[model samples]
Target: MESLRELFKIGFGPSSSHTMGPQRAASKIKEQYPNASRFEVELYGSLALTGKGHLTDYIIKQTLGKQTIVRFKSDRLPYHPNGMKFYVYQDEEILDTITAYSIGGGTVEYEGSKLQQTKQIYPHKNLKEIIQYIEDNGISFYDYVLNYEDEHFKAYLFEVLDSMFTCVQNGLHHEGVIPGRLQLKRVAKSMYQQAINTRRESDRERLLVSSYAYAVSEENACGNKIVTAPTCGASGILPAVLFYCYKQLEIPRKELIKALAVAGLFGNVIKHNATISGADGGCQAEVGSACAMAAAAYGWILELNNSLIEYAAEMGLEHNLGLTCDPVGGYVQIPCIERNGFGALRAIDAASYAKQLGYLRKNKVSFDSIVNVMKETGKDLNSAYKETSLGGLAKEFGLKDGD
Candidate 1:
């Protein structure tokens, strides 16, 4: 039941769990050993498997200095899949050693006392508790968050929304191959231009939204500063949907901010009950959570009732269950970039469907239950499918190094 700090992290990232987390950890370790002669960082599990492509070493080097040594440990950690060990050396003597885990959604946990960093702002953690509170108090989730979280959180959210918009703008204009072996061309500009020139009205919204999602996600892939809707890998979904809501649906800026609050609440529930890391729960945790967060926000913007909002959120994750995190060549391009467009589309569809089915009690599944199932399913998945790029499309494509 930690605060929703992970919901909207503004950082440069090709991968949050891989790049941002390690850089953050390195910065922390640097603070502890400012005068150390040298530093070495060991990346474990998924972080190591994809560190080269995700620029984990590059970011760590930037934080610790050019001479910083980075070693990749393919062996999985007992604590979390994305683990890093930082060491400081002076005159051939070990000054300090630190270990940390990037537990999805840009959250880093130190070797010990990780729990000490978390604070529960809301008394309620799960959907059921919040639902009960809503039923009793007759106030919406929006009200609940406003009542519980202080003004600072709201101000932070405004900044987050502004940053999201700025990211989309930056992505749309930037073109050329992202720095990597794949040499993938930026598509947001072309997509946006194509959408604008579309002769058919039916495809306008879809095209534009996909372009927006592509913009943010492609920016993430290039290690540009972007907000992690849940995480950087799936950052595009929420922004795409929100932008569409603002431009197409004409939702006001004030209402859109409120919608963001509701979305953060939904994401916080999943982060508490399940997770939001591809390394932990495959792509289902990352993209699925983003899809659900977007759907919930859309539902709230539509003024749908609480049950319908939950239903929208649940469908988003349910439909994406078991989706593997198999980034091609360990880079967050390929399936990852296109995946954000699909996730955003699914989120929009899920929200519309939930709104259409409002008050119909024919559902057999619940949002809270789906969160549990997602975590269990993630735990049951093979390591290769969980962001190691060893299985699924990552393997079958036979482009291990994209060589």
Candidate 2:
């Protein structure tokens, strides 16, 4: 809780695990050897397994080219198998050739002769030993690092949540209209149109109705290009609640921070007790847990009651108990893109329903029990369904082949 590692991370992605993690790892290596002339990056384990489809290779190239993961655009980055390699220069002197990988969930590792370690092995790679190195050497680190002040941390969380809301609102407005290599689905487009028509309604009302629209139209919603929530694949839930509170409810920024604080609490609980990486626990841990977090946050805002917030989160977690993270062609396209809407809608519903019921009744279900159920469900799930693009909609349907 004091570290804020789980709540905040930096890196590239079509996925937090596959894309962002690798880029973060490479960036850490660059920080380690500011004066090094050359570097090489490599991937191992799960990163290498679905690295290509997840854009792990592309993310590494951008990291090495002196590009921060948070700013690189997926479309502009190179996508070859050896991935992209960058030769850097400082003051007309040739530097190093840097290589890296997108190891999912914003974790990265360095693979080169110049470096002593090949893997970025910290539990939260963004806060790895390299950050310690910077601190030890009295060098400036990235602005995103936590300063550990309650008020300051709260301010940072609110700012990130506000930015997330803005990004989603903008993304939904133009997710499909401005097309990209990834084809747009008609569902999101239709829902966006419907939302436009219903703008005059209360923000909460608009969100409740539009959540369903976006969920049904998952193929079309655009993810946050760089400054986005975890990933487009699980983006909508966090934004929907925040936007609703901001617009319809007229909730203050401080209140929004409270909601997000609650969210971080619940999210960390899951990350510590179960898993968030798709490779480990599948989509349930990602979108499902995110939905649960959002639901809990919304409940916190609505009920002004802690138990109610916990209940709402547990309900959200329980509902998505068996969800999987199977993406077609291993890319975060297909069902992956649309899944965010569903997760968001589910979170909204859970919050609303919990508000109608008393907290005591809701708490009988228990968050711990729900988490256990999720872990069990994940264990029961087929490996093909675990973001491998080998089963579920990725296989039973023609999504993999078509992609």
Best by TM-score: 1
| lDDT tens digits by residue: candidate 1, 58-88 | 8899999976999988697799999888777
Best lDDT goes to which candidate?
1
Model 2 CA deviation exceeding 4 Å by range: 10-12, 35-40, 65-151, 175-182, 185-190, 196-223, 226-232, 359-362, 397-403
Lowest summed lDDT across 10 adjacent residues in model 2 is found at 73-82
Model 2 per-residue lDDT tens digits across residues 163-243: 665554544544433133346443554565666567566653754545532532242232234322333356556766676
The segments of candidate 1 whose C-alpha lies over 4 angstroms from its true place after superposition are: 113-116, 401-403
Question: Each candidate's root-mean-square deviation in Å?
Answer: 1.7, 9.2
TM-score per candidate, in order?
0.96, 0.71
Positional deviation of residue 343's Cα in model 1 after best superposition, in angstroms: 0.8
Backbone clash tally (model 1): 0
